[model samples]
Every structure is written in structure tokens, then in C-alpha cells.
Target: MIQRSTRFGHLLRSFRDAPSSSSSKIGGYLLASTASSPLKQACVSTNRDDEFANLDWDNLGFGMVPTDYMYIMKCSKGESFEHGQLSNFGNIELSPASGVLNYGQGAYEGTKAYKKEDGRLLLFRPDQNAIRLKNSAERMCMPSPSIDQFVDALKQTVLANKRWVPPPGKGSLYIRPLIMGSGEILGLGAAPEYTFLIYVSPVGNYFKEGLAPLNLYVEEEFDRASRGGTGGVKSITNYAPGLKALTRAKNRGFSDVLYLDSTNKKNLEEVSSCNIFVVKGNAISTPATNGTILAGITRKSIIDIARDHGYQVEEGTITVDELIHADEVFCTGTAVGVAPVGSITYQGTRMEFKTGAQTVSQQLYFTLEAIKKGLIEDKKGWIVEIDQ
Candidate 1:
């Protein structure tokens, strides 16, 4: 059976379902969906407003279940980003010549909010997400929205649909803000116009029952990143190329595939959805963000936390053999948080590492969650409390 998390992994996952010639209702959530012709994937839902309040919060799997409203903003060539909002939860009009589809000038940011134990709302590192998003936009040759405006829009949007957030411990509403080139030209160039939009959806736990370590198939044939590639930025195009490789790895019964440097397949990069790390002796190491690998916010935070807690950490090119020799291995990201790697296969030689993840992984998981829920001291002031 298809898992729920994969339902809308990206801005939305395109399903094979034909665009309903007529708006036939799918349950009571989506009233009318205006999916485009040849609609590959979508999160069809409606503005019932009460949809989120009535969901089975605790049982949510992963990925957002779209609700009523979404926020949209746009910009033109040499013009500052203009405040725009789209209330209805449906598709936006993009010219066939739009850059996101043609030249692939699209970038996005991902972060989450947690319900504080006090019943107020708390956002996990909104400023960080804003900065990363702006950086992503710049990498894709798109304009950046001011940090304050981005945070303000997120706050307003979340509050407007506050009820949609799954109850604490149940799930968190994943917030995705996408900016794409709107320039409707066929030339191999940037979109003259760009559109920035934010959407919210209640999602379930990333790891359903419990955190299970993953079996990663180290891919030697396909490199996940290359010098000067757009891997440093969170671009959608970075993922599509991995689908075939990932499918093959899954067929081999591995949860994910590991990518290495394109120049030399010897160095470790990261998994398709998250950054990677290996624990050896008393030190933790991951590949350096050398233009290719994604600079994951969580990955950076983990490094700091590990150091603060007295664990040595290193960031540079890590070889596949080094990983097989690691005392423990884990992957980090916004989604799935930290997943331990039990074993990795390199050139058909399966290497098994002891389970239970690294000690730091366990410590950081609870510590991060505690900080998010406002139960512990946020030394770096990372948590942003909403709802006052």
C-alpha cells in the first residue's frame, strides 16, 4: 500500500489520477478542485475551515493533508515582492513559460510549529528558515522576500489556520513556502516575474510507531551532487533525478540511497531527503557543504549541540569505507529528524553497524523536541512563540 507521507512529499505529490472532468467530491474535505489538465499529483481539499479540527491528529502519518486556505505573494522584474494572498486552497495560475517548469528556477523552505505545553503556539527557528529560504531564492536567481515579511507572513498564515495544526504529540502542520519564476518566456533564462506562496497542511509523525534505523544502499553509479551544482539550495529539481535510483534501491529493500560526490564516487554526500553523518570513537563527522550537498538547518544545529555536549565533530568529505567503519551512523533533516543507519551496502558488500543509533542522536532528538515544545531552556533562543 502507498504510504501517506509520500502522498504529497513535495509542494504536492502528483498522483496518476485524471483531473476529474467534473468536480466530483472526494469525501467532504475538498469541495471543488481545479486541477490542471494532465494533473500528475495534487492535495485536493476544501475550505471547510473545520477540517483540521476534526482530523485524527495522533494517527497522522506524514506529509500535510491540505485544508482551507493558502497564502500567495508575487513579484515582477526589478520590482520588490508584492503582498498577495490566495484564500482558496487550490492551484495557482502559472504560465507555460514559467521558470519553475522550464528553467527550474524554484526554491522552497520547510519548518514547523509546535503547541507549547502552555497552550500557546511556538515556531521552531522561523528566522533560520527565512534566511535559508532567502538564500535558496538567491541561488536559484530568484528575489528574496525580506526576513521580517517572511516571518510575519508565516505567523499570520499559521494563526489564520491555527486549528489545522495537529495537537501536540500528534503531528505538526508542515509549512512550505515556494517561490518560482513566473516569467512567461521560452528563452533559456530566468523568469521575468516570480511568485512566492506559502501553504499549510497537518501531517502525522514522520516515523509512525517508533524510530527505526534505515538500511541505506550507497549508490556508486549516481552521484547526488557535483561541484557548482544547485545541491546547496533546496530546489525541487534536485529530487526528480533521484526517483529512478531510489526506486531501484527500494526494490533492493533499502529505505533510501546514499549519494556521493560526482567527481569521485568515493566521498559521501547525503541521502535524497536528508543530510548524513557518521559517529566514530568520540567524534561525529559529515560531509562539508561544498556547493553540492544541502546545507540543512538541522544538520548545522546537530553539530553545535554535539559540540556543546562535549562531543567532537567534523565536517568534510567522508569516504564510504569510513562510514562502514563508523561506530554508529545517522541521518538528519527537518523531516524524519534523525534516522539511525543500521547498515550500508557498497558495491554489493553489505556492512552492518551496531544499532541503537549514536548516543548523541537519542540525546539530540529528545532535546530538540523539548526545546520546540518550550519545556526546556532554549539556549540559542531558537524557538519563536506565536499566539503571544
Candidate 2:
């Protein structure tokens, strides 16, 4: 096995000698060419004999347990991404003045890889994640990798850590792609350099309640995103600020916090980490992405799936009053997947919704899961198969 220190040294040397020639400006930051070195194979072949013996796949939860490899690439002040390599998973050295640390100039994406019964691995709509990351980068004044680069890196990373992928019907490998201004800059503007990295972790469910219905706290005191803020994108800065509200809600025996629009404070926006949807009879609706709510890939897919089931789906404003009175409510995202919301409490008034095996949320969840595990035909072409 390659020593972690040795692999890090090799990575530093490669970055130091990276090329710097052509340049363009995007979002006020210099877009430069990528490093000249060919992409290196960072995934060491694993001995399959002992790979799956130690993992408790059925009991896995959403937490970070290091896997075998991670993908890394860098770009200087005026270059585009040229190459990337898989490296042994370990701690990364960073400057104290790095843009991400000082100014929060970074964005990230979350998607998952599932293991099929036939040993094939699949990714769901990674292209949507790629496009979302680029949009986030642009909003944060940072450079981003192309959709091809992003998808290729994800494939390589998943293959490298194939051993960590949970078995079919168990869990999945959660892939996180982060783009940050790695360049050291003491100023209050964009950084001079950037880094793009992808890492994977095997996870079961994000909420401790698992597939059961969730209890949500309607956050009247805290606003998740303002109208002209970074709420519409997956910027890294957008998450931490909501922790206070989330903590309070969880402490009060709630699954998560439900946020309303920052401006009106009446229109339902979304939950802290997932998008919100309401089902009334045969009609379904979710808050429109009006520059204040993150456009979720799973949310979009659920809309399509609901429509396919002959339900009338609408993307428009939904008030907290409308949400509280809906026949059923649920949340959707990469981490949460599709989770039913059983109840919501606002200013001491609590309301409950129907959630069970027959609800639309459960139906959509099962359909998506079946399609992901290759049990059903992928009619929308959403699944990207990766060769192991």
C-alpha cells in the first residue's frame, strides 16, 4: 500500500509543476488551463477476497467513514481543468489564507452510487449535479469543472472504492464533489487558485427515523435563504448558517426544520437540507425555485414520477397554511431521498398529515429505488452505469 504521506507529496509536486498559459475570465475570476500531466490512476486494485466481509451493510447510517480513494485536480489563476488523479484518502494540507477558509468561496455537490444485484454500479442524474455545481461556482465567483470532467471523476472515484459500495437492497455509496478556491488570498475578493475534489462514503439513511415519517418544526424565527442570496445554489457557505435552527428543531424532538420564504415569511420555501412537497387528493405541488430555494435533482425526478402516475403536479408558491392542510407531505433530496413528513408545528399549533404505504411519497420512493437498483427498466435514461 502507498503511504499516505508519500502520496500527498506526489500530489504537491504535480500541482507545483502544473501549466499556466491561456486564461479567460468568468464571474470575475481568471479561468486557466488545467495541469499538463495525464490523469493518474489513484485507485489501487483491491483484493476481492476480504473486501465485503467486515462491513455491516444493513445497519449503515449517513456518516463519513473513509474509503479507499478520492479524486483531486487543481487550476491556477488562468487555466481550465486539464487532468485529475485518484489519490489515497487522507488529510489535505491547506494554507491558512485559503479562500475557502477565509471567505467561504466554494461549492459542493451530493449524489450517490448504488450497487446492482449483478455487481454493476449506477449513478442517478449526475449531469444535473454537474450543471448545478457550475451554477454554484459561478455564483460564488469560483471556477468549476465541466460536466464531462465531473461525471468522469465520479465514475473513477466510485470504481476505485468499489469495495465500499453497499450490496444491493442495503445502502449506497454517497459521492461528494467539492470545488473551492484553494489559492491563498488575504484580500476580500476571489482567490487566485482553485481545487476540485470528489470523495465517497457508504451510507444508509440520512435521518435517524430511517424510512418512517418525519416530524418537522416550522421555523418562524429563522430564515434559510434571502431572495438575493446563495440559497438557489449548492454553495458550501449556505449550509453552516442554518445549523443553529436545525439544532434547535432537532432538540425539540423534530426530524428537521421547515423554512419559509425570507421575504414573505408565509410562502413555504423548503426544509434545511431537502425540498418540500405537498399532496392534496390527486394533485401535488412544490415550491418553485425562485432564486431562494435549491433546485433538487431528486425533487425534479419525483415531480416527473408523480406526473407519470397521472397526478397533477404544480410548481408554484405554497403557503405554510396550505402545507399544513395537505393530505400528505414529504421531503426530497440526495441525502434524504424521499421522506414523508408526518406533522409540522408552528407557534405551538401542530398539524398532522397522512403517511404510510399508500401515500404518494412511499410510491415514488419505491419506484425510484427500484429503478436505481436495476429492478425496473430505466425509462427516463436517468441511470448512468459504471463498469467495475
Candidate 3:
């Protein structure tokens, strides 16, 4: 069984051992909500032996599953987050004129919790996510939780929903930390209040192909982000704009859409939801984060891993011609992990890349996976263990 911290172990056990009809006291610190609502019904099983979700782990997909509890905290426009609570997994009530609904004032971060073979749960580089979330909140004109509060909330939520964590090698529990302007806002500006919430889901692979090489379509007409926009941050508004290009590409029988720079339209920016890297011989290159591309946590870790393995990695302008002539290409993100690109179709021209177990992408993927699952020593101190 996974070890819980002495401070909160008993409180978490109470959530598991309580009767379904009985009230569950998550903890004094958590200020567990006992609100009686249709969607707020507690979902945890009363049986302590029920250690895992009763589902086909092999058939999991990248979608949301209502877990036991979600973490939520709120603050005003200029106030900092002080406390949060673990409430029953349910729908949240928001005003129709909320900033998030009207003006799209929100940001979100993605991370994962891996269940090791020995019943230990591991979080990979959650601090990086916290820092990024803070940056995103500033960019979105909202308040955010401190790094300590953010990491603590993540651990508490993961432990509370431990049963939802997939078994070793099956998948992982995808964690999404969201901050939004929840207060009423009819005017065209930041709301008076903000909210931070986190929810998780067990996911297998991001793409339907499941680790297979991805076929990407280059989108030259549509731009994912501009020079001084929210593209560099994890703003909620950045994604919807790319949906048109992505949907069109999917209809054309492609895995995802790769975008080019808005100014020149000749340089590669990134894929719809992940960062891209081109490999030519022992050299690796990716688009630099120049207020357009998101500095992905996975992308940064992969670059460090590649350089540590004696590969010369560069961050600069990668033109379409350079991408087409590259030996190998891959994309990285929390959801996609490291996915190799088999072919890129740019304006009726198709360019193929090297893939399979023998490629550099595969090597980096395995190394990252090993570090995540605790199969190898985490010399970089990226893995944070949730233990008693």
C-alpha cells in the first residue's frame, strides 16, 4: 500500500473507511466540504481493500474520469491563496458573466502521477508546473497559489484519488491545475475574484495510435500564436484558436497540425499542443521560446537528457526546409510524452523521419519513462515521492 504522511494519513483513511451515507471529514486543514448536491456525491469506495479503479487499464484513453475528490482554493484579484480544500468530485458553479466564460481569463497546467510497482506514487517535476502556472496566472491577470501550496495540494489530491492511479506500465493519473477568473465580470477587464482548482484522470496515450509514429500536417495559413500574445503561457484562450486548423488536419487523415511562425510563415513553431524537435545526426534543434512557443517541461527535460547523453542540442530558428531535411523529428509534452513524427505533409510535399526502438527519440523516451517510474536512479531530483 502507498504510505501516507503522518500528518494527513488518518484524515485520508477516514475518507476511505467512512460509510457512503456518513459524512466524511477530509481533514481540518483541508476544510472538507460536505455540501449536499447532486454532483457533489462522494465517489470513494468504503472498502479499504479496493486499491485500484475497476476498469480495463489496457484500454484507458486521454479523457476525464470523475475521481474521488478535487482540490480547490480561491482568492481575490490581488490576494494570495491561503488555504484549499478537497471536495467531492463534482461540477462547479460559475457565473454566466464570469471572466473565464466571457473574456477567457484563465490558465491551466498539466502534470502526471505515476504508480510504481511497490504501491508508491510519484510526481515528475511538479515544481516546474507550479512555476509555469504562476507565470501563466500573472500573464492572465489573476492570483495563484504559492509553490509550496501548489505542490501540497497536488500530493493531497493524488493520495485521495490513489485508487484511480493506473497500475505499473498501464498508464498514469493526469493532473490538471487550473486557475481562472471566476467572479462576475460584465466589463472588459479582470474579474474581482479568482479560483484555483485541480482535477485528475487516468489516461493511456494522448494519440489514438498509442506510441506509434504521428503523421502531422503543416498549417501555413493559420497561426497558433502571435509575437506578444498568451501563447508563451498556458492560457485557456490559446488552444481554441488552433482548433480550426487541428480539425481540418484531422479530417485530412493526419495525427495533428504543425504550425509555422506568423510573421515569416517559413519557420517551424510547434505542434498544436506540444513542442517539436528535429534531429539530424548527433545534433538536436527546437524552436526557441521567444514569446510565441510554450516552454514545455517535458521539452526542457528532454533537451537536458539529450545533452547529457553527448548530443549537441540547439534552440533557434528551424526553417521548414531544415525540418523537411532532418533525419528524425519528435514532439514532447505532458500528455504526448515523446512522440516521434513519421511524416510531415507541407503543401503537398511529404517528408519522412526515422523512428522505432533504435532511434534517438526512442532512447530519450525510454530514459524519461525510466526516471518517471523509478526504474532508474533520479539523479536530477525531478521525482517527488508522496510518502508517510
Candidate 4:
């Protein structure tokens, strides 16, 4: 095994001499060119391994289980991110006064890799995550890796940690790509240096109930995001504020907290982490991504799938009263795929909705999963199969 310090030094040297060329495209994003460098070989081999990690695949949960390898890259304030390398998955060094630690100048993205029965791994709409990461970086005043760099690093990390990927239908390797201002700064400004890292964790399901409907509590006292803030972006700071509400709701016997818009407080925005949709008759509506709610990739795909199947999908302001009367409600995100809302309690009144296999959530969930796992032909070209 390579010594940790030696591997880190190797990564730094390779990052210094990395190239800026692309050879091909996958899922509408350019893939960085790769030569047979020893560093690259150390990251991933072209052959798949049948031997797997010793873990309870059937009892996996949505928690961190360290994989074998991770991807890391660095950039200065005024420079574009050029290159990165794979290293052992471990804790990273950060300054005591880092900008991310002080001013919260960080953003993150979540995507997943699914293992196929034939030993192939699949990534669904990774280009979308790359684009969203760029948007978040811009919002947080940090330089970001290009889509090519982002997608390539993701592929390298997943390929290097392929053994940790759960078996098909068991779970998936959760890919988390993060961009943070790691440089030290005492004042409230962006840091001088930034870091982009990707790590993977094999996860079973987001909810412990395993696809059972969620009982959400509407948080009227706390506001998740203001109208003109970083609510639309995946900023690290944006999540911390909602945790208080989430914890309080969980304490009150609810699975999660559904927050409303800060401006009116009557308009439904989203849950703490996922985007929500309300279904009535043939019409499906979700809150618009208007600088207050995240533009979730899973939410976007579900809209397309729903529209293609003759459902009228709309993105607009969905009020709290409308949610109470909806026939069905569901949430979507990378973590919570298409989870039906069993009940929503607002201001001491609870409203129930239709759940189970006959609802729209289940139908869309199956369709999305089918396309993601390559069980169906990827006509939309959303699946990016990693090179074995």
C-alpha cells in the first residue's frame, strides 16, 4: 500500500502537471483525456473485480461507509480548476480560519452510481449535477471545475471504489462532490484557495422505513430561505439553518419538516432537503425554482417523465391550502427519489393523501429507476456507463 503522505505528494505533483484536453463526450459533457500515467492506473484499472467488500449489503443505511479511494483537486482564487487526482479516502487538512469554516463558502452536490448485474456501473444525469455545481460555485463566489473535469473525476472515483458499490437492487454508491473555500481568512470574504473533492458511500435508502410514505410537519415558525438568498443553490450554509427545524419536527414524531416561503409564509416551498410536488387529477404542480427552492435533478426528470406520459406538469407557486387538498404529494431529490407523502400536518391539522403502488409517485419511481439501471433502453441518453 502506498503511504498516505507519499500518495498526497504524488497527487499534488500530478495536479501541477495535469492537462486541459478532452477526448470524448458522455451524457453531453466532455470527458477529460487520460494517458496511461502511473497515477491514473493507481486510480482505476480497466478490468472489473468480482471480489467485493465485506459489508452487509442487505442492511445498508444512509450513512458514511468509507470506500477505498476518493478524488481531490485544488485551485487558487483567480484561476480556473485545471486538474485533480485520486487518493485514499481520509480526512483532509483545513486551516483553523478557513473561509468555509467561517463564512460558509462551500457548496455540495449529490449523485449516485448503480451496479448492474453484469458488473457494469451506471450514473444517471451526472452532467446535470456538474452544471448545478457550477451554478452553486458561482453563487458562493468560488471557482469551480469545468464540466469535463467534474465528470471525469466522478468517473475515476466511482471506478476506483467499484468494489464498494452495492449489488444491483441492494443499494447504490452515493457520490458526493464538494467545493469549498479552504484558504484561511479572518474577515468575511472568499478564501484565496479552493478545493474540490468527491467521495462515495454505499447507501441503501434515505428513509429508514424503506419507501414507506413520510409524515411531514409544516414549519410555520421558521423560514427555510428568504426570497433573495442562497436558497436556490446548494450552499453548505443553507442546510444548517434547516436542521433546527428538522430536529424539532423529528422530535415531534414527524419524519421531516416542510418549510414555506419566507416572504408570504403561505406558499409551499419544499422540505428540508427535497423538492415537493402536488398532484390533483391529471395536473401535477411543483414550486418554481425562483431563487428560493433548489432545482433538483430528480425533480426535473420526474417532470419530463410525467409529461411524456400524458400528465400536465406545471411549475408555479403552490400554496399551503392547495397542498391540503391534493390527491397525492411526493418529494424528489438524489437522496429521496420519489417518496410519497403520507400526511402533512400544518398548524395542528393533518391532511392525508394517497400512497402505495397505485399512485403517480410509484409509477414515476419505477420509470426513473428502470432508466437509471439500464433495464430499459436509455433513449434519452441519461445513463453514463463508467468504463470498467
Where is model 3 more than 4 Å wrong at Cα? 1-24, 27-48
RMSD of each: 9.2, 6.0, 7.4, 4.8
Model with the higher TM-score, candidate 3 or 4: 4
Full-model lDDT for every candidate: 0.73, 0.85, 0.87, 0.86
Candidate 3 local lDDT, 107-175, one digit each (tens): 999999999889999999999999999999999888888787898889878877888999999999999
Q: Which stretches of model 4 miss by more than 4 angstroms?
A: 1-10, 14-50
Q: Alpha carbon lDDT of residue 188, candidate 1?
A: 84
User: Which tens-of-lDDT digit does each residue in 124-241 have in candidate 4?
Assistant: 9999999999999999999998776788788888887888989999989999999999899999888999999999999988987789999999999999899779999999999888
- State every prediction's TM-score relative to the real structure: 0.84, 0.91, 0.89, 0.91
Identify the candidate with maximal lDDT: 3
Which pairs of residues clash in candidate 1, taking residues 3 or more apart in a chain or in different chains? 14-40, 14-41, 15-40, 15-41, 30-45, 30-46, 60-204
What would you estimate as the lDDT of candidate 4? 0.86
Q: Can you rank all candidates by lDDT, best first?
A: 3, 4, 2, 1
Q: Answer with 2 or 4, whichever has the higher lDDT.
A: 4
- lDDT per residue as tens, model 1, 1-388: 2223321222221211324442333323222233342111123334444524877765777855776667666678678773433354665666676788788888898887777545687888888888888888887888978887787667756765677877778767788888889678697877888877888888765654347778889887777767888889898778889988999998888888999888878888889889998888788999999889888988988888889888899998798878656888888888877777778999888887666634667877777778777878999988887643
Clashes of 1: 7
